[model samples]
Target: MEAVLYVLHGSRVKLACEQAISFIETCMEEIPVAIQEYCFLELADPTIEEAYARCVERGAATIIVIPVLLLTAVHAKEDIPNELARVSKQFPNVEMRYSRPIGVHGNMVEILMERLSETGKLIDKDSMVLLIGRGSSDPDVKRDLTTIAGFLKERAGIGRVDTCYLTAAKPGLEEALEIVKQSKYKKIYVVPYLLFTGILMNTIQKTIRKSLADQDKEFILCQYLGYHPLINSVLRQRVIEAGGGQDLVSRHA
Candidate 1:
């Protein structure tokens, strides 16, 4: 069987890792290929190099390196490519393809919509919706956030979606929350634009609780976008694109 190697940005807990595993595994249904392994960029076992070694050992001729990243930051543009070059040298017989980060895809908005509605509260069209991203120094990474926010706006019925950052960028969650509160809207939803639960998500939630308790602002902090099936669909597209399979652009569209 063929193999696909998922290159995830690692996390601290086994649950998050398991989420990544399940995310990719669900995507694997379309391919008659085998899942060689799932590896991490850091903070967990089975790093990318190790996954490549296993793929090479298994005589896999093609491997797809899907970065389970929200944005194409330094990790995807610089680190992943450099590592892929090294992996290529080690496994000359196997060709590897690196895919765009998960953020660039459109299915994410569907997940975001589902996540937003998960609160059982329809986003007030007149209110402000702050879409918080795990910001990055990379321009490409930042651009993806803007694109997603704008897409949500175009979709409508979710209110005016505004962009903000959790870290490493401007207009932090606090600032966005302040903007929304000052506006006529009484309710503000701070949507965490993360793939899984982690330190950042934890910090955001705590900060929200404390801020509300202190200022007595009315805000609802929803959970991070847990391993959604739409994400699984996006991952499959990336894997298929990297695997040199049929055109998947329309599928992603």
Candidate 2:
């Protein structure tokens, strides 16, 4: 039997974890696989090992592991893989395949545009966008986000879009905000390129509140990228590709 194992990044916040679970549950509904299980990489119930065991107990001879990550980072590239390697050794008879993260998709840019529009503010060429990432030492994180920001700028018909990180990368949120404060753009839209609400979202809100309180600029914090339909579509595509289905053409290309 074939099984699909979804590995989430997990969260310290209960609501964040719950949101992830709910989102994955919805995504799983579209998958036709008989044995589908979800587990957290950390800070939540049903660890990867436990979930893998469940798939085996359910008579899954082949397990497809999908990392529910936004970008190609350490967690997706190393942490989860390392954990999988450890667990796979225990199930030598089972064949395991890994899938890619939802990296650099046109739908993601659409999500950003949707998020900006949700702010109910006019996005003019004079307006600037500051996209915030989760931060990673992996250079791919910066490269991919820069590409997404470029896409956002072009597609949204905006003059400029800048990228920053929450941790472990250059141009932290405070520094990015400071630079934007001195720029010519007065109307700034801050979009968190995050999946769910958690400490990072709260931190962004708090920082924006404290830093831009006295500034005369218009700062609109757009919503984080949640379980949007577009994301679900991307995950469906990922699942399809992982299951030895025909490869789909890149929409962003």
Candidate 3:
């Protein structure tokens, strides 16, 4: 039998971690495979090795490891693979295949649109957008986010889409605020390109609320993407590709 080993980047916040596990459960139901288990990379229980062992114990001859990450960061590109490699050395009889992260998928655009709609704000030519991400040291991560911002700018018909980072990268949120301060747009939407709510989301929200309290500019913060149906669809597609003998190549835009 074949199984799917879903890996999520665990968070210290309980709600955030629970959200990832919930997403994994939903993915398990949507995926074609019957046997599936989930684990976290760090800061949570049931590490990757434990999850892989559970799959093997269920009599799985092949295991497809799917990373539920948004970018090609170190976690997706190095840490998860290293853990899988260590475990694969122990399970000589079972074949292990790895899949790419859900980076720059088109469905994500739909999810962002849904989030924007939920805010009850209309996108107009005078509206500005700030696509904020949990920044990484990796250059590819920034490049992919910039590409996503460009797509949103064109498709959503917003006046401008500025890319910013929460930390560890250029154009931090404060700098982004400085840019927003100079812009004459009536409304600026701060879209967080995150999977679930955590310290970062709270921090961003607090910062925006405090800084723009007395300003005339309307600053709207959209909800983070969490367990959306489109995400489930993307997970299923990645599993299918991995099970079909495709190698784990860089699939980002």
lDDT tens digits by residue: candidate 3, 88-197: 89899999989999998888888888888899988887798888999999998998898888887777877788989998899999889988888888799888999988
Worst 10 residues of 2 by lDDT: 244-253
- Once fitted onto the true fold, the runs of candidate 3 whose alpha carbons sit more than 4 angstroms away are 245-253
Against the true structure, whose TM-score is highest? 2
Clashes of each: 0, 0, 0
At residue 207, candidate 3 shows an lDDT of 87
Clashing pairs in 1: none
Error at 26, model 1, angstroms: 2.7
TM-score winner between 2 and 3, please give it. 2
Candidate 1 Cα RMSD (Å): 3.3
Candidate 1 TM-score, true structure as reference:
0.89
What lDDT does the true structure give each of the candidates? 0.75, 0.91, 0.86
- Score candidate 3 by TM-score against the native: 0.94
Residue 187 displacement (Å), model 2: 0.5
Comparing 2 and 3 on lDDT, the stronger one: 2
Q: Which stretches of candidate 1 lie over 4 Å from their true place?
A: 213-217, 247-253
